[model samples]
Target: MQIVIVLSLLFIAIILFATEKISVDIVTLIMLIVLCTTRIITPEEAFAGFSSDFIVILASIFVLTAALEETGILEFMIARLVKIASRGANILLFLVMLISGTISAFMNNTTVTAMFVSPLMGVSRKLKFSASKILMPLAFASILGGTCTLIGTSTNVAVSGYIDKAGLAPVGMFEISGIGLIIFVVGMLYMMTIGRRLLPNHQDSALTEEYKMQKYITEVLVLPNSPLVNQLVYASDLSKKKFKMLNIIRGKEKFLPDYRTRIQANDILLVEGEIDDLITIRETKGIEIMADVVLEDALQSPDIRLAEILITAHSNLIRHTIREIDFQRRYGLTVLAVSRQGETLRTQISDVKLKLGDLLLVQGAQERLNYLRSNQHLAVLEEFSQVLFRKRKGIITISAFVLAIILGSFSVLPLSISFLGAAVISILTGCISTDRAYEAIDWRLLILIGGMTAFGAAMDKSGAAQFLANGIVDWLAPFGKISVLAGFIFLTVFLTQPMSNAAAALVIVPVALQTAAALDSNPRTFAIAVMLAASVSLVTPFEPSCILVYGPGKYRFSDFLKVGSGLTLILILIIIFMVPVFWPL
Candidate 1:
């Protein structure tokens, strides 16, 4: 009965996750609560996952990555990449994938992917290449690259921890690197050859039209009979409707009108708002649309509005409140919108807190705009004219990261301590700032991992894992241990597509371990198979890396299913074949 209850809860969690009816973190927490309330697992056991080393490591890594971002280090590296790859689009794409994949091998793949999206989009646009072609490749490269190292992804670290907990010798970093290298090679080859051809070549055009804001700016004349003749600008639709009253030209005196100033007859008000809405306002508010003057002038002289600006690490805008920035005053530019990771900011953009990699849609003087590229503290992502700053900090940051890897790999220090120490050294050496360090860490992801870790414990302690494993073992007894191992791997890979990779791994690892015990085979082998299968989900664009590229690539959901499904199939076959060979039953 406990087993049935647990399975039912698990099924419900999966459904909730698939439908996104509730947040994944919430779903995981609810599962834990249900398990504990029903006495399926002890409260202590249900909460053990919160104290797991995997959570600690993931949290620390977020802080470390956050520091790197704050110091403008990633931007510096991308700038250099763009300068070196000035050859052509094909070479640029290849180099970008190569670099993105290589970096993802050591860093968090999502963070690495996020750092590159803006620059990659800018580079693609400047080179007159389709962003859609490069973005998907970039996302795929990060996913493939993550397979190369234990620290490459949280999934890898979680699996390793699980192996140690299950009383098996943990796999060395290079043990999986061999197969990962092969996968990377095959994946990159496909991207450069056939995959590139399959991508859509959407033509470059201004994205502003998508917002439907073209009709917003219009001019109005204060007629003598207007009721608003003696009223301040704030009392009229210009202020009420959030239109910027740019200027008033009376006779030959062109003056920028203050928002609080009153209007008079013959004064022209340059306002911005939807044309239909403005027409309605004019009719209702007793004002006349300056169609012959403002409309005709706008039609005759089409002004090009472009904004160039730097994204600073310490800007209060990072991850909090965009509305607080008062961007119009702080930057002297009107923010039409913002773009991040190929996804346009869909919220009330003016109120959204700016993150480090955000690309602002600004409108200001072109001359002053170009100056933003030279701001070393913030990356002027779209401008390629600026020289890349190869400051000494790059060496310091790289060395610190390398030292951490060595210490962790050699067991000279615990993986958590090694990274923490490296992060400290990087800060002290001026490689990254304290503010940036904080921004670099992904707090939401950390919370999700921590919460899910506890959920995993609940699954294990409830006998849920054991019961499921036993049932599966009984069902597949005729096929033997290898088939059982294959079944587990296939099950995990499928689960990962609909749910998060971490959640899927946490769900499957316990069952796979239990099954391995029943078959008298190596539990570590089964655990590793589950780990690899869960992390290598290339069959959908739901992953963060994939979502980052989805909008920029102009890719349909079907595109990923079409191309990524085949890749997933190949990966599954490889895992099934390789896990047995490396850790024999």
Candidate 2:
């Protein structure tokens, strides 16, 4: 009955995760609540996940990564490496993947991809290369690189913690590096050779059109008899209809409009809204929609500009529509359009609920855009031309990070303590503020991992893991030990598409460990394989790193299928053969 109850809850959790009606963190919390209420696990056992060392290590890494980004140290390093990597398209792709994978082994893969997306866009433009060719590789490299270290991804830490709690040897910092390096090399080679040809070559368009914002922005000439001609700009029909009047072009002089500014006859008003709204105003107010004017050109000035911003996981805009939030008044910026799940949405943006990974085209003051760069919610997609690097802060924070790595690697301190200490030093040295540090930690991810840990405990205490493992072992033992190992790897890769990599790995760890024990094989081998398998999910863009690039790369769902499907299969084969040799399953 206890096993049936745990299995039933697990089934429901998987369904909820796939539908995504509720957030993953919420699903995890609900799972915990069910486990405690059913008495399948004690409240103390159900809550033990929150206090795991894995949470501390994962949270600290977020702080350290954010501090590096805030001080511009990570950007500087990437820029220098990219400059040296310039050659032809194939060479550039290889170098990018190589460097990206290496760095991803230490940093969060999403943060690494976010840091590169804008600069890689700039590099692609300079070389006359298609961004579609490089952005996918950048995202893919970061994911592959994460397989190289225990700290490279939260999945590794979570799995290690589970192993320790289950009375097995804990994973070392660099224990997986041998097999991880092989996978990275194979992945880079595959991308440069066969995968490069599969990538799309979408031609580059202008910055405004690139974000598909042209149709939403329009220009109109104010007529002599227009009601808006003599009225304050804030009270005009355009503002009433939610059309943001970006600028007033009076003859050759361009002026930004404010509440006090009044429109004059013959003034050309550049505005952003649905075309239908602009057309309605044009016919009703006797203003002519200037057909020949370039909307992008008129929308720019020394003070006002256009850029792309990504909706991050922590953004307050999630699940809220633009109109409901009164976005313009709240952020002092106008959203021109939005890109989501590889679709460019130009019309009815106000009605669209914002989701994580949505890229927004915005027109605002340079100052506000700069402020948005530091905002945890919105990620600016264009590179800031001005260097904000603080040399002393960068040096101090970097040194602290190195010290933490050394101490953790040499066994002088536990990995969690070392990283947490480094995060403290980073904050104390002023590399980033206290608020920024708090914002940097991906609280949702932490909660998801923490909650899942309890779920794993529930499965163990209720005998669900052993029951499931017995079924798997009976089915696969006929094919031998290698086949049993392959079965777990296949299960993990399949689960990752519907769930987060960390969550999927956590869900499967208890079962895989029990299966290994049943077969008298090395449980660590099964644990490590499951960890690596979660990172090898390249068949879908649902992975956070892949989602970050999907819109910006202008890729289709099929694009990931065509290129990533092949890579995932190849990596799976590599893991099946390579993992056993290292851990001797």
Find the candidate with the highest lDDT and give its number. Answer: 2
For each of the candidates, the C-alpha root-mean-square deviation to the true structure, in angstroms, is 4.6, 2.6
Question: Over the stretch 52-71, how does candidate 1's per-residue lDDT look in tens digits?
Answer: 66666676676666555545
C-alpha-based local distance difference test score of model 1 = 0.70
The models' CA-based lDDT, in order, is: 0.70, 0.86
Worst 10 residues of 1 by lDDT: 295-304
**Poorest 10 consecutive residues by lDDT, candidate 2:** 381-390
User: Residues 1-585, candidate 2, lDDT per residue (tens digit)?
Assistant: 999999998888889998999988899888888888989888898878889888899899999988988888887887876676556676778878988898899989888887777777777777788889999999999999999988999999999998999998789999999999998888888888889999999876666767656666778888899878788887887788887777788998886666678999999988777766766776676588886336577677888888888876556788899989987777778777788986778767879999878988888888988887766567787753424777889998888888998999999999889999999999988898999899888888889988898899888989999999999999999999999999999999999988888989998999999999999999999999999999998988998889888887888899999999999999999999999999998
Q: List runs of model 2 lying over 4 Å from the truth.
A: 207-218, 223-225, 229-235, 242-246, 256-266, 272-295, 301-304, 312-332, 365-379, 382-386
